[model samples]
Target chain A: MLKLDREIRDAIVAHAKRDHPDEACGIVAGPEGSDTAARLVEMVNAAGSPTFYEFDSTELLRLYREMDDNDEEPVVVYHSHTATEAYPSRTDTDLAQEPNAHYVLVSTREHGNSAGPVEFRSYRIVDGVVTEEDVTIQE
Target chain B: MAIEVRIPTILRTYTDGQKSVEASGSTLQQIVDDLEANHSGIKERLVEDSGELRRFVNVYVNDEDVRFTGGLETELSDGDQVVILPAVAGGC
Candidate 1:
């Protein structure tokens, strides 16, 4: 199971709505080894395709460096699935390198650019296998 | 061998359950080769016999995907972090 702050969850939903049609991807960084996500770092989708998502390489590098300097690690790696369910696709599971991080998928298929019932789910992708986990929103 | 290569859980078996290892290389390919020398079986999983990155594998140099930077030719600096992971779908 993964625990996310209500604010972080709302922000993720906002990002998904903001990038409707095209997928949005980002990470939430937390103190290294803490397993608690604290900071939100929204990223540009390099692919910019509704069917695909990739992080902007240069921005990703800078974010990683910043996290390192602050003794942080990506605790929650998230992306929006504009037209699909809140689940990890083959591509998403393939790119899940951080075994310790929670992989969150939000489906904007219902809301699109507006606000409605968004499906936000979490998973643990290890070695190409995705195991869905419950998400607890902390107020 | 100042570069730190972070091995994913599936690949940890090759590194004797190690999460991260240190190796040296000026380029991404060399670093992978060095990793192969120390941890066998990882190279085959990451790189194809055609000498290209496997379709399912994603190699990131300092959090930047190597395919975008320069593939196996991406330059590396000391203390850089190399991460290797499988490529799976993100949505249903």
Candidate 2:
């Protein structure tokens, strides 16, 4: 199970809504070994396609260096599925190299940019295997 | 020439959990070969059978992306730092 702060969850949903018709991707970094998703680092979607999302290479390097300097790790790696269910696609599972991260998928298919509920789910993708897990929001 | 290679968490298995290791090479390809010589099966993850860097893997030499610096043929010098990171990517 993944415990996420309520505000961060809302922020992720909002980001997904804002980027509707295009995929949005980012990571929440926290102190190393903490497993607590504390810092939400929004990233630009270099692919900028509804069916794809990739962090810019330069930005990716900077992000990692910052995390390393702070002794942090990406606790939650998230992306939005603008038109699909909140689940890992074959591409997601295949390229997910972060074995210790909580892969969060937010699906905006039902409501698009509207204020209705969206499917927010979490999973663990490791070694080409994806296992869904529960997400508990905390105040 | 000794180059310091920083390994990502996912590829730490190849470095026996050491975040960074030292290898010798005058070019990126030779460094990879040296890495494989010390850590078998790691070259396959960084380089494809076609001998090109994997699409989802990013390699940097002293903060410059190897892609723009001749890729596998990028020259290296002693005390250079190399960092390898898998692309943070996916799609639906």
Candidate 3:
């Protein structure tokens, strides 16, 4: 089972909301483990709009270097669907280079209402395949 | 026994917003056919004109990948979860 922290979920929702009228993308950093209770270290935006997400491999490399410098590894990568549900599209599957990393998708449609609840789901992409797992959110 | 198929977000519009559904089949292709019987346009979204999985789509069984196993012929069992994920291209 995949586990997500409440804060992470909120962050995903907020990021999706912030990018309303378009899609939002980012990365989730944490320790390497199957445990869903891992603490989120950071949320880095892809930097720009609905048509494209620029993942600065250089920045990611630097961050990875820093993490290596600190003896840690990046755990997961996350992004959002502004007009759709929390599922991977064909484009998403094609670009899933990190088979070991968790792929989290947040849906921002229903959350438009202040009273509406946010919808988020997590998955694992391995060898170009996407598998959805139950995500347990921790407080 | 029938296998349980999980629908991804993008295809939900064709499935009337269903996140998961049940289909009777022993292989991925059969399951997809069963789904198309109930919901039109599903197979089109998942497959190309030549019957290949779309470039942006990924189907997984449990934690294993269907492509590495057998593509459309991958075997299935009752209660097994099949996840359909399409590559998401939109982002800022």
Candidate 4:
């Protein structure tokens, strides 16, 4: 199961809402070997398309270097699907390289940018296989 | 010339779980060839059949993306750092 703080969950939802038409992507980093998701680093969607999301290459490098210096690793890698369910698409499963990270998919299809519930789900995608996992929101 | 290549987690299997390894070459392609010689089977993961860098893999030579720096032909010097990362990308 992926345990996330309530505030972090809310922030992810808000980010998805804010980028309604375009996909939003980011990562939550924590100390190496620590599964706790403590630092939320929002990434720019270089694709800037509703159906696609890609972190800018340069920014990606910097992010990795910073994480290296801090001895942190991405605990949760997240993205939003504006018109689809909170699930991993074929593309998502194929491109998932972080086998250790919990892939979070937040779907804003139901409410768009409005104030309503969105589907926030987590999964583990490894070696082209995606397994949906339970999420426990911690207050 | 010795170049330090930082391997990403996903590719550690090719490096015997080593995070960084030393390679020698004057260009990116030569460096990849040297890596393949030592690691065996790693070149296929980074290079496609068409002799181009794989789409999902990003290679950097000293902070500049190899794609912007003449791709596999990017010149390298001794003490240069190379970082390989899988691009964070997906589409619905």
Best by DockQ: 2
lDDT of 2 by residue, B1-92 (tens): 98999999999998899999999999999999999999999999999999999999999999998999999999998899999999999998
Clashes of each: 14, 0, 13, 0
Ten consecutive residues with minimal summed lDDT in candidate 1 chain B? B83-92
Judge the docking of candidate 3 as incorrect, acceptable, medium or high. Answer: incorrect
Task: Highest lDDT: give the candidate number.
Answer: 2
List model 1 lDDT by residue over B36-68, tens digit each. Answer: 999888899888899998865777887778888
lDDT of 4 by residue, A1-139 (tens): 9999999999999999999989999999999998999999999999999999999999999999999999999999999999999999999999999989999999999999899999999999999999999999999
The reply for model 2, stretches above 4 Å from the true place, is none
Winner on lDDT between 2 and 3 is: 2
The parts of candidate 3 lying over 4 Å away from their true place are: A33-47, A112-115, B1-92
- On TM-score, who's better, 1 or 4? 4
Model 4 ranges with Cα > 4 A deviation: none
For residues B9-92, could you state the per-residue lDDT of candidate 3 as single tens digits? 457777887868888888888988999999998999788899887755667776465778888888888888777765433341
lDDT of 4 by residue, B1-92 (tens): 99999999999999999999999999999999999999999999999999999999999999998999999999999999999999999988
How far residue B64's Cα lies from its native spot in candidate 2, in Å, is 1.2
Query: Candidates' TM-scores?
Result: 0.79, 0.99, 0.53, 0.99
Instruction: Please tell me what DockQ candidate 1 reaches.
Output: 0.33
- Ranked by lDDT, the better of candidates 1 and 4 is 4
- The better-scoring model by DockQ among 3 and 4 is 4
TM-score of 1: 0.79
How does model 3 score by TM-score? 0.53
